[model samples]
Target: MGAGLPADDRARAIIDLVRGQGYQTIEALAAQFGKTTQTIRRDVNLLCDRGLLRRKHGGVELPPEDENLAYPARQVLNIEAKRRIAELVARNVPDNATLFFGIGTTPEQCALALSDHPGLRVMTNNLNVAMALTRNPSCEITIAGGRLRNLDRDVVAAEARDFFSRFSVDIGIYGVGAVAEDGTLLDFGLDEVEMRRSLAQHCRQRFLVLDHSKFGRDATVRGGHITEATAVFTDRPVPPAIAGQLKEAGIRLVVWSDDATHTASSNGRG
Candidate 1:
C-alpha cells in the first residue's frame, strides 16, 4: 500500500525530504510527493515568503549568500531585551562625555537611549547610529570617513580607521558578532574587525553591548578578546561555562533583565 498521509502533512514531508538533500527542483519535489507541479510550486512560494527557504531559478534552496542577510530583521527580534540593555548603557554614560559607538542594532538602541541626554559628543562608523544621534540637538555627532559598506551600513575602510584615531573618547560602546568561551570576540569581515580594534584603542574604557545569541557563536574573524573590555552589557545570563571563562580572564559580566529590580554583576581578572 502507498504511504498514507494528509495533504498538509504530505506537503511538509516533501519539503523536509528536499531540504535534507540540500536543494531540489520543482519537478523532483512533485514527483516524490505524487502531487501536481502547480501544487508544489505554491508550497515553494509560500515557504519562500515565510523565510523558511529561498526560491531560486531552477528550484528552492536555502537563503542567498549574504553576510548581513538577517540583519534587517534583527532589530525586531528580542527588541524589549535590547531596549533594557540600551538603557543600562545609557545610565552608565557620564554627562557631556565623548563616546565612540560601534555598528549593529544593539549600538543603534544605545544611541536611542542617549537621545534625550544633552551635551554629549558621539563619534561612530555606523550610519544608523549617527542618524539616531542627529535628533538630539545638544549632542555633537561625527561619522568616521571611509568606504560605506552597504550590507552592514557602516564605514569600514582604512580612511575611517584613520579618522577614528584622531580623537580619544572616555568610553567606547561596541557590538560584536560573537563571544567565544575563551573570551575572544568575533566579526564577519576584516575591515570591521580592524575598525573595532581602532575604536578600542582610542577609548579609555570599552563596553561590549551584546544580546544572548552572541554568546556562543564565532564568526570568521576575531575583533578582540573579552578581557579587552571593561564591561559587557547583555540582556540575560550567560552559560555557566562561558561565564566562568570570562571570570578567569578578568572581565566583568553585567546582565540586565526585564525586571527593573534585578541586576546581576560578576567579575573575573586575567
Candidate 2:
C-alpha cells in the first residue's frame, strides 16, 4: 500500500503506471496504491504542476501525448534524428520570411539550424528557439510573453495567444505530441492545442516536423491534422499505409537523408 511507501516512491510508481497505460482515473489510481482519493488527487496535482502529467476531467494522463518524458529529458533523446530533421526544415524556408516556431525539440533544432540564416524574422513562444535565433546578430526575433511553462519552455497563456494573433507569417513550423493513423495531429494540453490552431491561422504555409516515433501514437487533445500541413518532414520513411493517406490528402512527405536515391527507395515502402 502507498501508506507505507515514501512520497517519492509513490509518485514514481504512479508515473510508471501512467506511462505504461497512457491514462488512468483518479479513483482507479488511488485504489491501486491503497491511498485515499484526496491524497492521490494531491499527488496528481503536484505532478501536473511539475509538467509531468496532464490532468483531465476523470483522471490524469501522461504529459503531452507524443512526449512521455519531461522537457529537459526529451531534449536529450533522439538528438541525431532531430538535428537531421531540423536541417531539412531550415533548408525549406525563404531567407527573409516571417517564421512561427512552435514549442518542442524539433522546432528548437530547426531554430538552431536557422542560426546561419540571417534576415529571418522569427516569432516564437519557445524560449529555447528564440534564444537560438538571438545568438545570430542578423536574425530578428520576437518572443511571445505570457505564463512560461517549464515542460516545453514556452509561453501558454491567453496573453501569448493574443500576441501571436497580431501577426501573419510566411511559414509556421510545428511539432506534434503524436500522429494518429488517419493523420490527425494530437497533443495533451488544451492550451497547446489552441495555440497551434491559432498559429495555423496566421501562416501562409504550415509544416509539421517530427521523427518517425511520433507516428501511430495518440494524444489527449487533437491539434490540426496532417491535411493542415503544407509538408511533413521527418528523419524516417513513413509506413506506406500512412504515406498513402498523406498523399491522398495532398500533403507532401519529405524524408531527410544524405543519400537521395536511398532515401527515395527507403521512403517508398509500407
Highest-scoring model, lDDT: 2
Candidate 1 positional error at 172, Å? 0.1
lDDT of 2 by residue, 1-270 (tens): 555678778988888899898789999988999998899999888788767778988799876644456786568556789998888877778788789989888999999998988799988988989988888788888899889887668997877777668898899998888888877888878888888888888888888889987898767788777777788889988877778877777777889777743333223112
- Could you tell me every candidate's TM-score relative to the true structure? 0.75, 0.72
- Model 1 regions more than 4 Å off: 1-70, 267-270
**Model 2 misplaced stretches (Cα beyond 4 Å):** 1-67, 258-270
lDDT of 1 by residue, 85-195 (tens): 898888788789899999888999999999988899998999989989999999999888768878568898877778668899999999887777777888888987998
**Candidate 1 global CA lDDT score:** 0.80
* Worst window of 10 by summed lDDT in candidate 1: 64-73
Candidate models: Cα lDDT each: 0.80, 0.82
- Alpha-carbon lDDT of model 2: 0.82
